[model samples]
Target: MPELLSPRIDAISFRQLRLFESVGRLCSVRRGSEECNLSQPAVTQSLAKLEQMIGVELFERRPSGSYLTPLGRILYSRVVRMLKQMVTALFELEVPGGQVGAEAIVHRLTRSQVRSLVAIIEHGTFAAAAAALQITEGSLQRAARDLECNLRKNILFRSADGVIVTPAGIACGRRMSLALQEIDWAINEIDVARDIGESRIVIGALPFGGSVLLASMLDEFLATQSKVDVRIATESTSEMMQLLRDGKVDLVIGLTQETVGDDLVSQTLAETPYEVVARRGHPLTGQSHVNHEDLIKYDWVVGMPNSNRRNCFDRLFIDGPKPRTPIATSALLFIRHLLAGSNRLTLMTSYELQHETMLVRVPIDVPLPCPTIGITTRADWLPTALHRDFINLIKSRVNTRSIMGVTRTAA
Candidate 1:
């Protein structure tokens, strides 16, 4: 039987792929030239070479503007995925002693090579990307040629305006990147365990957690562990999620409630009671009894409006649309400062307010609804032994410490 598709894969140069990806992204020859810092003719030559190799026109040109052809569009999507994988690998390499060195020999891709792939994805022109790297476009072209020969596939497609990515190109980049990450992580796991009988675990906490329970618990946990490396970084709740997703840190301890998203796995760690606090002798403090009605009258310094705390506050005061005259909302420290210096009231978890000198809880008898704190990790990444141990440590602390002004047993 005759072969319906080409039995042999077409050859594509990495430079050509870079050039095509650039043209596809930028959408114009002149822009591609300016970005690549190449003479228009040079970019044209690269695109032409790519088209010749692929046996397809990857883009369509019109008077209004240039766009990818159907085939080209498919390729562009693939290229984007591939480039993301390449960038992910480079980010991993920044960590000291990742597995890239040993496994890289088999793939013959250095960190620079991985970065170059990303540059092509970002800038979309070989000349532009090469200029950014301070190397000759011809040098980049040669590198692509070498990569294509090794892969044995026409990884890039091209046309008059720019280049397009092929499915094969995208798949190869993604597979290679994932392989590199797993390898690096595996090596790190071994090194961490070998250095200590138990692996040294790293935890990233949100600013709220950093200032309160997490800080005290971290110190106690480290004291108990003879061999462990624990790192605590303060960031916003959303940023903590990103770090966990990327596996840059083992677990996140914060006020964020867990939700199922792309690759994230959330476990409810605890519920923290919240309350409104104000400076001593403030108007709310003077009231014989504090009530939600009176509490809403003052401009509150609150968590960001969309956060669970703020959202709950909104619901609590739902009868009257949050009297928009003016209210303050910010991260914990700003709220703390406002509460310390002025009569401005702010809502905080009991743990956060425990150490403050100037702030006192209002007399409102209602239980300020609590926000759930949780630990999250990428769903695809199974928790390591060390990761589980760190989680247990958090649970133990919650069991002992007062998160919402009451001990765990009482709550």
Candidate 2:
């Protein structure tokens, strides 16, 4: 994407976006004029003005007809999605017994102003935010000031330390962020609609799910939807939750926990039973029975502190003295390597240790509690068609038959 310079966001209207979309779809300005019920000259002028506002040549005018340039295709996709959403919103407002005359509260601020407010809130400093947005400090400050004046509230204040968002400002910024997400989602939706080979999804996964569960499902999804791009991040639950709230990730998959905040929605897919695993040649590998007392003697390798696996491990030994200091990490490959080369034990779901011939599960009669593994997404998120399809594929891959016998535990 390029840095779009102004005529200001207010200059760009829904009408212009709609016209552009029609022209791009039909590949003829005359047909677009007919579709939009405007004269051909008016449609052509509106498109020219839109291009000038965004500082991009949306189409190439040849003898045959007007064909979209690369930038035009991008703009057309976004416009179509935005128009669809606007129509949907209007329909929702017009539902029976609904507030018939209700309309969106018009703000005096421009899109750039709202974007500036959100950027400042996210970056925490005017200079840094301006740099990120490719705008000058003066312009950003003026936009922020204009926003505060329009809202009739002090959105930000300068402190000795730095600029701080006021309580009201925080609330406003959150709404703006969500609105920005809607715009982004509109673009993603259009990409999916065009089948342009550029759709994308970002997923955050915990250690176990990323390594075992998501790995297989993603392979299947990509094989069929090869045009869709997928990026995966493995991080702690808290960190991933923050990313989800910030709209940096589309969804998260992992063991479910009671600590999840109200902003997220979780659906249990399956129950994953855990095992105490050690290197194949470790002293405890072939033992007839392994108890907590016997397991405490060896050094241990565990997930990062406060992680689901680590917390469960701690609870299993709550009555006994704490085991010797263990190597703490979240990297599965590193854990596998450490366990293979040293006298250490680690707890893992059977799925996690499935392909590792160097590691073996210690035979123990004591039943360790199983955790419910599932998918988590933002409560207010509206998925595009592709996103919904991908989610369905994941659900199909979950082994529902095994969930009944496993004991669920709070992580």
Candidate 3:
């Protein structure tokens, strides 16, 4: 909404947005004036400024009354949603409920304050945030203080350990971001309608299911859709969730258990078991019955420790002599290459090694944990039509022999 999620606090006036919402919903300037408690000229003037600011003629002036343009209809719907969420979050987040009411907060809180709080928390320091926001330290500090006061919560505080965004502050920042994402979503839709922007979906991937899911679905998705960009960002579980909350990553497709948030929803896509994979001609391949003893005889490459696959790897040698100096890494690509060129063995799922035709799954009579892979998204996320199609493709392409019907769980 404001230059790709920087809080467009400067570009948009909350009061103006509320006025826009009122006019669009009532479909008449007179009705909007009544609801907003403004004179007819004031409402009309505000609407003109808003349309000029967003560079879209939001309304077609009708002889009977005002009506939404095609783009106006899109922006208006999202703005209505954004305003509702702001009003609810401001009240429910335990602001002095009756004193500083939700509607008051919506009108009182400036976008600068919202953007400032988010930037401070995300950058983890005042100076860094000020630099990134290109604002004075005094201005940033004042914005944060004003925001904390409005919410009646201790957001940013200096402890002996330096600076910290209190859990409350973190929660507030997330809530603040939700509304901005709503606006950004509207802008994306506007771009699509004008045929001037590339439709992009940023997917968070784990080392697991996305590979198989993408291997099967990506080419087809691109072939069928035009001017679309699909990006996959692989990061630690925590980072991806942060990205999702910040509205950078649209949806995460991978190990879902590590995520914990009140705003996320997850759906199980596949449940896959771990396998001990090695080069086809490796010594373990010759054994019809592979045991921990035989596995320990060879060197091993491993996924990051404490992960389900790594736990299975660790248990393999727990009962007997452990392998000497097993390599530990979270990078599946490195592990895959290491497995083919050397006598290293590792515990990974069949879905991960589907493309590695030269690698053989050792016939190990061992009990291993099966990891559940799925898609996690913000509960209020507005997935575009293309994204919805891609998800449907995944649901249809990855099924039956993989996993049965999908189940959705919310925060």
Which candidate tops TM-score? 3
> What TM-score would you give candidate 3 relative to the actual structure?
0.83
Candidate 3: tens digits of C-alpha lDDT, residues 356-411: 66677777778677777778898887777777988888777776454422221111
lDDT tens digits by residue: candidate 2, 168-227? 566556655654455455444444555642667888988765557788777788888867
Residue 406 lDDT in candidate 1: 34
Clashing pairs in 2: none
Candidate 2, which ten residues in sequence have the lowest lDDT sum? 98-107
Question: CA shift at 153, candidate 2, in angstroms?
Answer: 2.2
State the local distance difference test value for candidate 3: 0.75
The TM-score values for the models, in the order shown, are: 0.57, 0.73, 0.83
**Candidate 2 regions with alpha-carbon error over 4 angstroms:** 1-106, 401-411
Model 3 residue 120 lDDT score: 77
* Backbone clash count for every predicted candidate, in the order shown: 9, 0, 0
Say what the RMSD of model 1 is: 18.0
